[model samples]
Target: MRFMKSFFLTTFNNHLIAYPTPINIHYAWSFGFLSLMCLTLQTVTGIFLAMHYTPHIALAFSSVEHTMRDVNFGWLTRYTHANGASMFFMVAYIHIFRGLYFGSYTKPKQWVWLVGIFIFTLMIMTAFMGYVLPWGQMSLWGATVMTNLVSALPMIGDYMVFWLWGGFSVDNATLNRFFSLHYTLPFVITATSLVHITLTHQEGSGNPLGIDSYSDKVNLYPYFVVKDTYGLFIFTFLFSVFLFFYPNLLGHSDNYVEANPMVTPNHIVPEWYFLPFYAILRSVPHKLWGVIAMLSSIIILSFIPWLHSTETRSSRFRPIYKIFYWTLVFCCLLLGWIGGMPVEEPYITMGQVLSVYYFSYFLTTLPMLGTVENNLMNYFNK
Candidate 1:
């Protein structure tokens, strides 16, 4: 019993069960731990699916069908994995935005946020690779469009595309490599997430009140464990509902058709989670410039902690900033809506307009808010 108690003190109990937590955290904090749980679920399901999956272009689609129709409970595993990816992103996006709103991206927490971004980048890469494993219509066309975007670069553009596909275009090599990466990247995310959690625990969780606690910390055993478990149960229940009931809700009908290299779909769309950035990619007139615009949108996320220069942390304390923040959120939604529309007039125009506002919020509003907001509000006061 003594040895067991010593082992417990050194292992799970110390690091997980009894870890320190901020007393003032809310449901938003629950999403981070939930994202971790979702990742585990995704990785486990993916491993089992992989055991039966064939990554060849000829066999990939059929293998997926075989897994779904022939293998024992394979349908459940595949659906869980598919729906799990969406759930993972949903929780992660909420977790990220919560950090943004509550100012968890500020100074000492900067490393934590950066590691979180690393995890996100890996997730996107992993998901993109996973999407192609089915070798369906959208999977093929989507892979083609995205990979061909690399050819827009100046000199090495062709080389970049060639290097990625290992051929003139996406084929068996591409499918084989994508499957390998899809199987590999979750482990990367898992390792990076561990670093993120360690750094976060080291920094301690930020609170809504934007206050840090040196002495006010609470044990993770009961309070937060129960709260996070409660949140996970609700989240899992809702996710399972989609898994069993509306399995195809987040997937596209186009993907139901198998690959035909000679034929292209009337319209190609990436997944819903990627829509806002996809809209940005198509908003510009020039192909190369459009590619840059899309990359810029993502690259800009890393600089947010430095961009909004202020002593203030949380948007809760800054009334003016909250308005701008919500406007940015609205801009993202508009971009997403525009992404699914035909690139013809009003949609293109609308996408271009919203794209400007998206950048403006980060590049203009945030930097300028510190200088003008108080004066503008004070002028109104007088």
Candidate 2:
């Protein structure tokens, strides 16, 4: 028993306490830790919510209501779980953007980036399924619209849609399946997150300078742990403002109504986190092409490690890349805005233009800009 205890303590110290981290990494580096905290909060609250949630379509909405109104502090539990999803995505996006800015995906850290992308994809799937569990108007229709996109595939599309729905339409089977997967996929995310952290530690953390800091590294304990704790305090304060003050601010008003297939809402929109991709989907007229575009928008990110041509990693060192990177961020925010607007007149045209630029920024701009920067640097040195 003593041997086992000693072994466990030593392993923990090696991985968590004494781990070497780049000395110059900033507070932005804390988002990865924040994301883990969000996941843990979601998982614990989800388990409690599940104890009272019904997977059947007929009772799902009422069960959620019961949990909110009848159960002790159930409202708090539900709100935390719901808002926690938003907080999770917010932190994850910041973490991803920070990685991009510091070129964390370059060289030896590519696997870490790839695993992080996989975790992100899983989060999208899991969040969509969780949205459907409330059995609200937007929830049902959002699931219908997203799952139907699978049918846009050439041959197996319809079959895949059927398999996803478990019937001709989104019904009880679909709810049960989504609930089960929603309950299970978080554990999968947890496992994958371990792999992600392991890979990151193996490659070591990247700093703002985007260079090897092997000689100037510091232990994960004390200094960085205190920094992360400070970040956590700020995060918790903001999270509480939303959780306690305005929980439903992030949710759709239409979702307050129980799902009625016969009476469709005037507009069907997904959660805010999904808006940018949803805009990309709506930009194309053809169903198949639109679906392809939407999927490509995300999948293209995974290829950035190979696409970039310059040896320089940090945007701070690459002036041209820094301009384009911020422009890309603006493009995403614009796409997200266009996504929530009515698909008519100017919105459609704007979405089309933004969508085109979005893909081009990934495929053409990144590689070409990197090449130009490399050429400029060589010319100056020569």
Candidate 3:
């Protein structure tokens, strides 16, 4: 027992206290720590909320209302869990963008990036399941629409959809399955997150300058710990503002109404975080192709470590790459905006065009840009 105690303490100190971090990394690096905090918040609040939640179709909505109105501080728990999801994704997206901009996916850190992407995919699955728990009008229909997309597969599509539904349609069985999975996946994510951090520490953290900082590193304690704490305080303040002042700002009004299978909403939209991929899914004319496009939009990110040919890691040294990076950012924002808009002419056309650019940015532009930058460097040296 004494040996075990010492072993654990030594491990903690090594990873958390004495870990070497790049000295030049700034507030953006803190987002990774912030993401971990969001996950913890979500897990704690989810556990509390689940205690009062009923997964049955007949009582699911009312159970949520009962928890809100009757249980002490239940509204706080529910809102925190709900909005905390958005916070998690917000922090995660920033962390990912920081990785992309600094080229954190390069060389030894490749597995760290890959594991982070896996965590993200799990987050999307968990969030999608959680969204259906309230059994609201939007929740029911959203589940129906999203599950139906599985039928786009060639052979076992219908069977897979049936398995996911656990019935002919979105009903009590579906809710039960989703609730079970939602309650379970966070623990899985937490475990996966440990792997991600372990891999990140194994390779050491990257910096804004995107250069080796092994000889000029600082301990994770004191300096970075203090900086991360400051970031946490600021993040808590903003989170509290949404929690107290505008708890439902990120939610859809249609969700306040109880689900009625007989009635369908005019616009069946998903949460804000999913809008970019949703736009890609809708942009394609065929259902199978649209689903493939939506899935590819995310999967393509995994290929970045291979697709990028430049030896340079940071956008700071690459002027042309920096411009293209921001353009890709704009393209994503436009896709997200287009996702929420009605499926009409100009929106459809716009989405199609941007979707093309989105793939092009990954497949053609990154590789070609690297070649151009390499050529420019060679000519200047001559």
| lDDT values, one for every candidate | 0.90, 0.94, 0.95
The numbered model that scores best in TM-score is 3
**Which 10-residue span in candidate 1 carries the lowest summed lDDT?**
370-379
Model 1, span 1-382: residue lDDT tens: 9999899787687668878887888899899989999999999999999999998988999999999999999999999998899999889889988988988898888889888988998999999999989999999999999999999999999999999998988999999999999999999999999899888877887999887778788889899899989998999789979988999999989888999999999999998889999999999999999999998998888898888677678888799889888888788888988898888999999999999998888898888896676667578889
Per-residue lDDT for 246 in model 3?
99
Candidate 2 lDDT, tens digit per residue, 1-382?
9999999998799778999988888999999999999999999999999999999989999999999999999999999999999999999999999988889999889999999999999999999999999999999999999999999989999999999999999999999999999999999999999999988888888999988888898899999999999999999999999999999999998888999988888888999999999999999999999999999988988998998788899998998899989998999999999999998989999999999999999889988999899889989999
**lDDT (Cα, tens digit) per residue for candidate 3, span 74-141:** 88988898899999999999999989899999998999999999999999999999999999999999
Candidate 2 stretches greater than 4 Å from native: 1-4
| Clash count list over all predictions | 0, 0, 0
**lDDT of model 1, residue 140:** 97
User: Which residue pairs in candidate 2 collide?
Assistant: none
Better of 1 and 2 by TM-score: 2
The per-prediction CA RMSD against the true structure, in angstroms, equals: 2.4, 1.0, 0.7
lDDT of 1 at 348: 92
Candidate 1 clash pair list: none
Weakest ten-residue segment in model 3 by summed lDDT: 207-216
Model with the higher lDDT, candidate 1 or 3: 3
